[model samples]
Target: MMRFILSLVLLPTLAAAQTPAADQARAAADALEAASNMLDDADGARDRVRALTETIQAFESGLGAMRTGLRQAAINEAQLTKKLQSREEEVAALLGALQSMGGGASPVALLHPDGPMGTARAGMLLAELTPALNARADALRTDLENVQTLRALQTDAAKRLQEGLTEVQAARIALNQAMANRTDLPKRFTADPVRTGILIASTETLDGFASGLSEIVTDEIEPAPVNLDGQIGELRLPVQGLILRRAGEADAAGVKRPGVIMATRPGAIVISPTAATIRYAGPLLDFGNVVILEPQADTLFVLAGLDVVYGEAGQVIAGGTPVGLMGGSLAEKGDELSPLREGTGTERSETLYIEVRQANRPQDPVAWFRTDEDG
Candidate 1:
């Protein structure tokens, strides 16, 4: 009977362990699915860029072929010229001799020599050289025509390539605009100044940021929560980038922290993960520029290592909202936006540091807040 009771106790303990393992497995599967979706979206953009590249490469290849054709035409022209040089000189002298005899002179007079035998020899030589001179002249003309055709092909390719480049730029603009149109999350919390200040002071470290969030009370009206608490592995990344560092990973300074480091594009737009109040928005020590956000009542999210930031302290930012623009080169010119190069997964212009804390204690963001991306 005692053994039976022990078995019963062990059965509940085993069942509890299995339940968490199953939840974690489901979370991991969801994360993978999300990541696949993100990759698919990225591929769509890459296809556009790839099309532009293919057009250019084909144009370049055509130009190269044309150049080769032209070179070959030059070689043909040179060979034809060599074969006909003597014929050209002979014809010139023959015409001069005939001119001296007058336009009314007979063909026999032009061939007049010291004797009948010499005259016969001259006529025979002219007969043989005539056909060869005619053939060489035709060959030289064909070579010139080929060279001209090649030149025209090269010019046409260059013109088409320029037009294609213009289209590529237009596509890039359209893509950026389309991406901009996607953020439509509704704001749920109002940022109050009194709370924002205390949050900022307490936000210096991950621990302090989490524990001191209640210093400023947030007013929630609609409570349009993204429900980040239950989302498990279905969280959207604040930015598209490769994860360079993960939570608990030692930094170059050998300090282990609860955050992930991401490599992003120049002038990338930073978005809020969930509807929340901006606890702080300004520069911080060693972080370049920092934007602290409070996503949950007891949770604080810290984003640092920005070149520039947008929005201000005490601002209510919605989930998927563009909180700020990253620094690096979104450095805008008067009215023109610079083009973004195609990502080969090697070109990262800026690094963003992300951290999550609940109730004033650092937690592994990778485990709590899941993203579709590597981080």
Candidate 2:
């Protein structure tokens, strides 16, 4: 029974032992589990939306339970403090009385002045009761420790919960908005399935696939009017996002690379910022679906991390032409952000990587596009 009480007090800390690392592992497993479970129970995107919404509601309910538990813990701590204080005084008074009454000399005789057998029996009983009193006193100290631990947990929870509330609101709103934007995107062109599939499957390098696309020349495509000469710092960004990276900066892998990485919204419209000919519009290595555009004879612009590509290589796409859509939470191309849902606006975000090259040399893209203050 004593062990059980200690376990109850340790419950909060034990639960928190599953750190962010544990959460990542659990989330991966849960995603697989959810996918398997949802296969039979779900039908389409709407079903997924409903499932996600339901999960959120369930989490909210758990939050309510946590709040209730915290309230009870606070009340229990206060009450226990009061009870233990009085009990401590009582124990001290009893000990003082025992000492003054000469319990040290002949405890049995002092308690029972009746007969020899009575004193012996009382002595044996007092020996057993002494340990019991000590045990009770030790339990009081343990209870105080438990109370302190519980209060700390509650304090941590409130701080984390307060920070997370703003994030939750922002995430849900962004996700829903992305879904809506995806629905609103106008279907301009339909890709040739057989050609795209063969291209993605057969080509080992992006350059090789781009060369193949360039071979399929058509006269229907129109050239963009953007003048590549003296247009530095005058071009609009190809997509809406926060520029998190600049050219020549080191990435997490510690490699000094050319190009910029933007944290973008899901389902964001990707456009060609100038009159350019498509050099590539397909997947390559870890870049997901990529699109390379050549606005001038010596300049090339690279756009990657798209969910869908709308233009073809050798096709002259005009300035502001919709080239693709940003990959989102519901993106079908097996992107990273999948399995792990979109993060809280910053870390583990949907990123678009862009590059600008002149004569095959890396150049800073920041000078070419307008920078936003929000980033």
Candidate 3:
């Protein structure tokens, strides 16, 4: 009879061990495994650089989902543990009561001292208490099992995270090598170094420098092959990140710029938003490494604060081409999981500054790029 009661109490715990957070963690692990396979296939791909880029992106998304799931799992485990600890005495008392009832079930113990009527009333009381006892036992078993499952999940997630980090690093290196070997991108025009140098030295601001771009080229420039006016507000962000500031928002230093700032993880890839010719691809005063592209005759897209830049000035690169990488170092192994447990996910430590200039005037970047708050 006691064994039957115990089995009934634990029946619900056999349903499933996976919570929503655990399911998400499993899905993220699957994604990471797929990305690893993609990395292996990239070597023989027709466009190896693009294939590797996609692999890196996949790893990034998987890592993010894993972190979120792990964080949630940690929180759930802590709550269950606290609840169990607070009710420790109550649980012990219940266990002692059950043990006594099972051990002392002799005929003499079953008979009440008062009479047959008293014994009948005691039997009725036991029937009423059975359901309540069963319910509490079931709840306690479930909580204990859930905590155990969550702990196991957290331990397994660490291994997945390490593999993902290593694979992404490999993908990034492969992409860099492939980009260096690439030679097929078309050239719109060749830049004049002396003229460009003179123009930069004479200009005082970005607007003035952009306005004098024509002064650096003496040859008759051909019209842009692609038009981007139809794609306004439909372009995806160059990097996967969250927008930190819209255009004209003041910074901590009380300074404002006509650009949007995006917060991205370390080593994030930055791609071109549209098919455009590189007007300039080097450092400018106070903007760090910068890439300026002209999709049309009078419009310029400026991406700044990159750690590394790609492509050369006057190259006509297609949309979604790799142009740069955001700056930061990857987290050290074993230490990376701590941030996820704390619910911060390594701080999104790098920032990309984006600006759109039309007709020599700075325009709001949100007007050109689609914004997603959740990214």
Candidate 4:
């Protein structure tokens, strides 16, 4: 009887243990489903955002044209006003002359003794003057009418421009809301190890494809230099960082290989390669924010994935000049850890990728560095 009682109690305990496990499994499945749904929603949201941005750009262009039209209209109106005022003055002067002549002053009294001929000449002058004054008045009236018409048209255009701007603002607000709503989706999905790993692998695959194309281009096509000059070499780290990758191998993306791969802690400064002109300063695919420097006329030094570019294109930079700040990659978040490095301690660290190209072909960057030392 005691054994039977013990079996009954143990049976209940075992059933309860299975219940929690089942609940946990169900919860995980639900979470995964939610993540999948979120991905679909994110894609839709991204499309909407892109559409809205384009619409906003179009509206901005229209607004610019409207502004130009408005300015020209204003100038036209000013000129018309001046012309109208001058015409009014001429009309007033002619009216005064007519009133004085009609007020019983003899035609001879109106003319100076030394002025031109006889009664026949004076009468002829009076006839011409009367018609000339009337024609002047008519022309002024017509000009005023045309000015009013143009002003009305300009006013309508201004109103339309205002409406367009309002629509653009509304669209922008909607886009912002959509983007905000979808922001959490990526985070939720990426938090899972499986999903994160998949994303990283996919990124790598895409990068490899891009690298392959770059290699083909680099091999087949040579970019002629606009100018050629002295060799620049021995580039020191703009800031300290670990070398993530070297220039020798083609990138996994199958593009032209970078000269060197350097990763830095977030906020690390990127210094100039040498005294050079900044050829390019903007975003590049996979590289994030990038700055390209022409150290010598023919040499192109690329700096990619920066937080900010400090100089403008065409601006000259001196050696060791801070060109940009290193930014954290969206793929990973930490104190800018370099995947190439094997340590976990808190030392100031960075990863730098360096490359040297001559006549659009890859050259040994090590040789350049060594040559600088020899010089």
Candidate 4 error regions (>4 Å): 1-233, 250-258, 329-342, 345-352, 370-375
| Worst-scoring 10-residue span by lDDT in model 1 | 334-343
Question: Candidate 1 clashing pairs?
Answer: 195-216, 210-360, 211-360
Point to the candidate with the largest TM-score: 3
Query: Mind giving the per-residue lDDT tens digits that candidate 1 earns over 1-375?
Result: 434422332222322222222333234333334433433444366443333223322322332232233334334434545654645675455445434433565766776657878888877987887677556444444433433443343344334433333433343344345434444434445567666566655566546644554554566554434356566456666765678889888989999877888887555556777777776777764577888887766667788887656566555665665555556643232111111222133335678888877767777777755565532
User: Please, what's the RMSD in Å of model 2?
Assistant: 14.6
Model 4, span 189-291: residue lDDT tens = 1123343334434555323322232222111222233332343344554544555555666667976564766655444546775676655555555666667
Which has the higher TM-score value, candidate number 2 or candidate number 3? 3
If scored against the real structure, what TM-score would every candidate get?
0.44, 0.41, 0.91, 0.33
Ordering by TM-score: 3, 1, 2, 4
Compared with the true structure, all predictions reach lDDT values of: 0.53, 0.57, 0.82, 0.49
Q: Model 1: residues >4 Å from true position, as ranges?
A: 1-206, 217-226, 330-346, 369-375
Model 4, TM vs. native: 0.33
| Candidate 1 lDDT for residue 319 | 67
Which has the higher lDDT value, candidate number 1 or candidate number 2? 2
Q: Which stretches of candidate 2 lie over 4 Å from their true place?
A: 1-226, 330-344, 373-375
lDDT (tens digit, per residue) of candidate 2 on 1-375: 434443433233434342332333334333333433433343355534344333333333333333334445455556667876777766565445445433346544465667878877977987887677556645554655555655565565444434333333343443354334443332223445467667767878544554455333334343334467677788878876678778778888986657898887555556788878777687776789899887876678889888877656566656776677676553332222221232334322578888887766667898788776332
TM-score of 2: 0.41
Candidate 3: TM-score? Answer: 0.91
RMSD of each: 25.8, 14.6, 2.7, 30.7
